[model samples]
Target: MSGVFIVSDNILSPIGLTTSKNFGQLKKSVSGIQKHHDTALSDQPFYAALFDQSGFIKDSDHKYTRFEQLLMASISDALQNSSVDAGDKKTVLIISSTKGNISLLETESYNPTIQKRISLPASAKLVAEYFGFINQPVVVSNACISGIMAILTGMRLIQSGQYENAVIAGADVISKFVLSGFQSFQAISPGPCKPFDVNRDGISLGEGAATIILSANPKNAQGIKVMGGAVSNDANHISAPSRTGAELCQAITKTLDNAHLLATDIDFISAHGTATIYNDEMEATAITLANLQTVPVNSLKGYYGHTLGAAGLIESIVSIHSLKENLVIPTLGFNETGTTNPLNICTDLLSGNFTNCLKTASGFGGCNAAVVFSKQ
Candidate 1:
């Protein structure tokens, strides 16, 4: 916890595929949702913030899958943005994703499962080798919490004195499989997602990548400090998020414990308001359960849709940058409250003297994680 720190974080987002672009859209409150015409996949008609149509990559040669392409580009910029020496063979790479190039399963005419060739952990190797990282650890968290789990792993390495620096990347592309699967559960919404909204409907599928440079020593320049983090599981249902929010409460409490801070010390709560009826309610319940208040809580899903694994770093990057700018965009498309525990979702961008911001995300497999960051 002493030496472990942040070098820099970069996000390749659905808004612009770059931090500047992402920030540009944020200032304007632009929603990334777009209509889908993948008629072959479904006739129900769903809107998602898919990156495949972003037109940021070449379609020729090496035949890289969408997930791989996003991951590669994100890692490249993250290294440059953080000024990390990728040539350092001693550095380690930690990669995380729920579905790693899963689209390749159908393209290659193979069944999609854990035994497939496009293994999530294997993709980490592909990312590490790109920059000559010889020592690396791959975590294939199929659960929704994989992205945060991945970052916590890298933080653990720095805290345990196992690595001086760790480059962490998370990516997952929207595909027919992921889309149709969410559609099957009736979790696909037709418009912009409204996290914690009374009229909230379901989840929105988005794709992108987020990379962060983690250093064992505190940064002397610009960067947010990764004070501490914790992960948990509801154990209530496989897909039905628990209303008790026991796991979510524990995750934040433990993170605060590690940071030696109290609930009042936290300036903002980046709740995992996925806009779904269950996810929003659970997060609100968790915040109240933790006995936390006097903190502004909001979800960025409305701005960027749900970018899956990339959301952790993407949202964290925004949270860190906001510490200086003191701006958190209003939650777009929200018209009413839908849950018992009301969320103080900023409907208009607000500036405050905030120093510590917390980001929390919960995914499938009953998993959840929370991290606290401070101004450096």
Candidate 2:
């Protein structure tokens, strides 16, 4: 299969509006999470990373909700950095999000006429129209792994000659619906999340949008290339992951095989460390099962919290930057080993030559995905 290169990318998050700004915050170990006492979101104090509403763009001619504005801003910034034309027939758009415009259902005025906008397909169509994309936009909503799966889909589409280039973006805003659902599971951390830490309790939810432009042509591209990707399911439970991590191990092995590389070739890992007990433990088991216990691993959740559908894409972009800068970002809230298997968890920023990286994410419904990226 032909390799897909990431030509340009953007991230709109609580810490920053552009990819460089977000990455700069990450380099400085700045945490975007904060405590909130809003009764609209939750009755109790909760920690979350949220975009400032005051900084949002306001336009009367094309009024867009906060969620839609985030997607537009991210994609706009990404397209500005890329040579691909959004209006060209050869280009495609792919959106990844577990929930798009779901917050529209919580309007204070409650306009029933706008209910249809909450549908994922409808939201995607609106964004596509705004961007002038010729092809119908594709939507991927496979839980937290949605972002990586979208990228994988784009790679396959380009490799199969379905499209010459793909613009992929994902965003999910934190709303009362999502917050209450996770709260029912007792999965919300009281404070900032501590991934892979002995004192880790639960996840700190976050909201963000991310975009990446992928193309088969890599002429002047100095960015990382998508070498391989694989997705697998445990089918063990609806909400819980497999106890043995066998399914995730298969995903990692298949991803490496598709990339024509081995576990040792991976310089580091960008893990889906949600700070939840089962999630961190399961990832550790999978890494050990894949004989990657010695490989350095870090999670961005400590800095950005859990960005749901946007997590994989946002972390992938940061990992690409990590490769470009030859630096390994430390796991922000880690203090000690918490899982059964020993993992080379990065506790501080380390500088070294990095060539290849493995990114992994596991979500609800027992779904897991692994993608390999290499510096070209």
lDDT string for model 2 (1-376, tens) is 6768989999989999999998899889998999988898999989999876733555566567777778888999999988999999989999999988887777644565576677788878888988899999999999999999999999999999999899999999999999999999999998899999999999999999999999988772766899998999998997998999999999999999999999989999999999999999999999999999999999999888999889999999999999999998999999999999979999999799999999999999999999999987
Worst 10 residues of 2 by lDDT: 54-63
lDDT of 2: 0.91
**Which residues of candidate 1, in runs, are more than 4 Å off?**
52-60, 111-116, 219-221
TM-score of 1: 0.93
Steric collisions counted per model: 4, 0
lDDT (C-alpha, whole model) for all candidates:
0.77, 0.91
Over the stretch 286-354, how does candidate 1's per-residue lDDT look in tens digits?
888887744787788877778777778778777877775777767776778788888677777888888
